[model samples]
Target chain A: MPIIAAQGLTMRFPRVTALDRLDVSVEAGVVGLVGANGAGKSTLIKILLGLLPPTEGRASVLGLDIAREGAAIRERVGFMPEYDCLPPDVSATEFVVHMARMCGLPPPAARERAADVLRHVGLYEERYRPIGGYSTGMKQKVKLAQALVHDPQLVFLDEPTNGLDPAGRDEMLALIRRIGSEFGISVLVTSHLLGELERVCDHVVIIDGGKLLRSQAVESFTAVSGVLTVEVQDGRDALGEHLHAQGVAVRPEGRVLVVDIAGERTYDLIRDGVADLGLHLVRLEQRRHHIEDVFTS
Target chain B: MSTSTIHDIGYRRYDGPRLGRGYLVRSLYVHNVRAVWGLGRPARAKVMPFLLAAVMVAPAFMDVGAVLLTDRAEVLMRYSAYAIYLQVVVSIFVASQAPVLASRELRFHVVPLYFSRPIAPLPFVLAKFAAMVTALLTMTAVPVVVLYVGGLIAKVPHPLTHLREFLLALVGCALFALVIGALGMAVAVLTPRRGFGVAAVIAVFLLSSAVVLLVQNIAEFRTNFSLAGNAGYFAPFNLVDIVQVRLLGAERTAEAVPDGFISGVLALLLCAALVGGAVAVLYRRFRKAGLS
Candidate 1:
């Protein structure tokens, strides 16, 4: 069953409608919510978390109604917010342990679980240091640690890679992927950058202007489009002309030629054309569709 | 010849039973209580509360010494008048620490983290309210306890009377804590900035008292009968004092409100109103703040 299901959920802020009748059901996996800023990604997550009541329609997380069962749902789900929400005065261990206790762990269990989760999130001795003295990456790790300390069945990571350098982003993404794959924990991770989600998400949901643009498995999302990218060793200009002469829609994209796939014969035509011109065909492959293509196409 | 691998401390799911909502409230209460006194915070955070508490307790010790040295009961400050006497220190305590309890969460945007858990917004707010009240109670009651013990240690005559008065002073202290705590928390929630919250809490007390005193003095000088006695109602501290004097049967020292059964009822009603109004404001503020 889908872990989170929303039916025409709409959230109207004072000035803008953050979610406009957004209907999407997220299955249990590493699901990526891809959208631009103000594209209703955070709004949908807030509604699912029962933090904000939707202006219209209904939603559910873990099969529990968001309106009536928010507390119960929150008991089972964890959230790592996009912005900083930790107390700088407290140490990471103290904060996470407190969060674990807030999630209903007894004192000793809370402390033990906090330590384990902090370790999982790659925080070491610095976990005892005040968060005020830590780097942004360390603070983010603490936020992640607190979210996971409760051992929630599902986790909502909102821009988890935000404010991180490249290596930090990679580490965070790897951690998120492991959370889904190894631990069997459902993850609904949001990012504006499509490439990051493409690496970790089993499924991708693209949103734009507070509306669902596309939702599909990650494999289907990057499935081959009806276009082939052809790269020749030399005479790239000649290759474009040759493909054009064959009544094919072809355009030069840098060192390669992008040809519209007319049918199965398009591949054969490209092959025969390459032979006819005596030019070395360095690469010929079906162009993979990107999540950004959902918006552009 | 040794094969020792690094301990694999990767992610592990907690299948342990989750406790109920009461735990959330209790944990928040404990955390906020510690936060109020800066127990787990930096040493610098400890200075203001401890300093004020020490200053408050020192007077009681000195009062006992004076009683001992002079062999007179006149040196003893009245039990019920303790809060009124140390009103400035108490107000500073409230003003300085209420923000730590009420405003710091909002300032750091950590409120959303709390609401995202099983904890509801009302309980979260109530926990903060309870913590501030406890902190205020400690600040007020510790000195009262000191005075009571010192009075007994000095062997003041009518020991039973001193104990009874001490008990009554504790009741008065509780009322003071509730009223001041409510007002401080209500003011602190208006802004997320600690400095602004502190300034606003102080202004609510000091400004109201200053205005009421100015008005009272003017009315007395100008022979305005209506404003002379009733002006004390304008300040929360003075209103609390009026309650301590009339309803609690404590002797009126500073406030000049006329003594009557109706005055006692009015003071009680106003105390209830202040507390109720503060809770109402906080509930409304937190309803919006839960998501903010």
Candidate 2:
């Protein structure tokens, strides 16, 4: 069964419709919801977290209705918001312990869990200091620690790499992947960077303008599209004309011949045709469809 | 040294008993109450609340000392009038700390963190309200207790009478705490910036009182005691004193006194209206802000 399923979920603001009829289903893995800034990624996460009610349609998480079981859903789901929400006056230990306690852990157990999560997030020796004194990387770790201290079944991390430097972004992505694979917790992480998601996410869901453009496994997203780009040291136009004469769809893209694989013997035909024309083959590689192709194609 | 083996302490799911929503609400209440006194905060954060508390109790202690030194029990202040007597300190406290309680979460955008948990928006608002009311209650009631004990130790006549007045003063303290806490929190929640929130709350208290006092002075010049007396309802401090005098049978001070029991009833109704109106406004405010 899917961990989360939305059916025609729509959320409308006064001046804008943040989410419009969004339909998605997510299984247990590190699923990346990829979108630009105003693409309703946060709105969908908020709806799934039961923080905002949709203007129309229904949504469910863990087989529970979002509208009716909002409290129950929140009880089992943890959320690391996109913006900075930590209280600056309190130490990380105090804040995480307080969050743990809010999640229904008793005082002693809350403190123990807080310490454990802080350590797990690689925050040591600095956990006792006030959060306001810490750097941005440290603050993001604190936010992640508080989200995990309660040991939720599923966690929604909104832009976990937001406001992080390159190194910090790498570390945060690694931590998110570990939470999904090692911890066996279902994660719904959102990011606009498709390259990073390709490295960490098992599945990617792309949304644009409050609509789901594509949702598939990460492997399928990067699979070869059967289009091969062939480059010759000499006579690139001659190669394209030869492939075209042989009833193959060929076009010249800059200094190379972009050949569509017409049949089962397309690769052999290309090699034979290049040799027959006495043209040296500089490069012949099959091109895979990029995740960015969803926008242009 | 033996090699340390890697322990696979992967994230463990919380299968232990999940407490109910009541626990979340109670935790918020405790957290906000501690925040009001600057507990678990920097030393500078602790200064204002503690200094105000000390300033509040010092007068009671000095009243006790003067009674002891001169052997005059009449110098001891009345317990029921403590809220009226220390109105400025209480106002300052409400102005400063209510922003700490009410606006800090909104200013820092931490309110969504709370609502995203197992708690509802109304409970979140209620918890803060309850915490502010409790903190204000402690501030007002503690000084009244000090005065009661001081008066008793100074050996004023009728100890039972003093106890009765002490109980009545506690009731007045509760009313003061509710009205002031509600008003301060309501004002503070309107503005997210702490400086603006603080200034707004102080203006609500001082400006409203000054306006009422000025109107009453004008009414007194015209010998209109009814109009001057009824003007007390516009001032929160005097309104509480009027309740104490009429409903609890405390002595009326030299300031505005109600014309009759009906006027006192009207003042009490207005107090109720103010508290209810503030709570209603706060409920809507938090509910809307939580969504946003």
Q: Give the best candidate by TM-score.
A: 1
Residue B238's C-alpha lDDT in candidate 2? 80
Candidate 1 local lDDT, A53-86, one digit each (tens) = 8999999999999999998999999999999898
Worst 10 residues of 2 chain A by lDDT: A288-297
Stretches of candidate 2 above 4 Å error? A228-285, B1-9
Model 1 segments more than 4 A misplaced? A13-15, A239-250, A259-282, B1-7, B217-227
lDDT of each: 0.86, 0.86
Point to the candidate with the largest DockQ. 1
The interface root mean square deviation of candidate 1 comes to 3.5
Q: Residue-pair clashes per candidate, as listed?
A: 0, 0
Q: Over all chains combined, what TM-score does candidate 1 have? A: 0.93
* Candidate 1, residue B178: how far the Cα is off, in Å: 0.8
